[model samples]
Target: MYATLPSPLGTLYIAASDDAILEVDFRDEAMPPCPPASPLLQAACDQLDAYFHGERQRFDLPLAPRGTPFQQEVWQALQSIPCGEHRSYRDIAALIGNPKAMRAVGMANGRNPVAIIIPCHRVIGAGGKLVGYAGGLERKVWLLQHEAGMADH
Candidate 1:
């Protein structure tokens, strides 16, 4: 099941499996915190808070995002993107041995079920403009700035 969570910045979508997290989405809704142990739901909420506060880099929680093999490969590559730098979809496509799969890379990027922790916002357009965030361009911009330490928050 999925639940929306509250944070300093905005609401977060958290989905969990019996073993781990499935997805995390940021949305414009008001919510309260959930317990952070026992139930996977609350634990996901806590991990997400750590991520947004910049206190956590790598995630230890389990994730079971449903996708095609190519999409999973793309998502894995996104996880390897260092905290502050950015990679283009083209760059990821090349790294994954699918140099011609730029759009496919983008498709995978958009389908990333776990949001911020996976760092999909770290991917940019070929020309360096921001593009392709499932969480809306504004939140994408916010995440980039937050990671860059430029967000006014």
Candidate 2:
């Protein structure tokens, strides 16, 4: 099941299974056909709204993103990055116990299905430079800035 929510960045398409969230995407194209509303999806959207409003820092929704083991490890590490803070691909690689997998970590970050909730935007390139984001670099910048602003409060 799935639902769409308007966000500061853009339209957010949230998908979920019966029990856990599967994906949250920012697509400019037409939204795919959606099934009936799922409570899980609605909750995910609600959490995202709180996040964009800076009222929420940590996401408490259940997520079931599908990916390889390495990707799973990378995504889990991403969630550990505190809000308003950032990490590099290299840092994520090391967190996952594979310091040599920086490039692979980047690839996995790009493939992250559950965008904001997974906190993929918190990952950056080396030297604190912004890098690849499936949701566009501009949105990535906005998310980071939004988090920083929230942290100041």
Tens digits of per-residue lDDT, candidate 2, 1-153, equal 678887777778888888999999997876655533977876787788898888999999898999999899999999999999999998998898999999999999999999899999999998989988999999999999999999999
Among all windows of 10 consecutive residues in model 2, the one with the lowest summed lDDT is 27-36
Q: On residues 1-153, what C-alpha lDDT tens digit does candidate 1 reach at each position?
A: 677777655777787767878878776755565444447887777777787777766677777788999998999899889876799999999999999999999999998989887889999997998986888888888777777773232
TM-score of 2: 0.94
Q: Report, for every candidate in turn, its global Cα lDDT versus the true structure.
A: 0.81, 0.89
Total backbone clashes of candidate 2, pairs 3 or more residues apart or in separate chains: 0
Each model's Cα RMSD: 2.9, 1.7
Native-referenced Cα lDDT, model 2 = 0.89
Among these predicted structures, which one has the highest TM-score?
2
Off by over 4 Å in 1: 29-39, 150-153
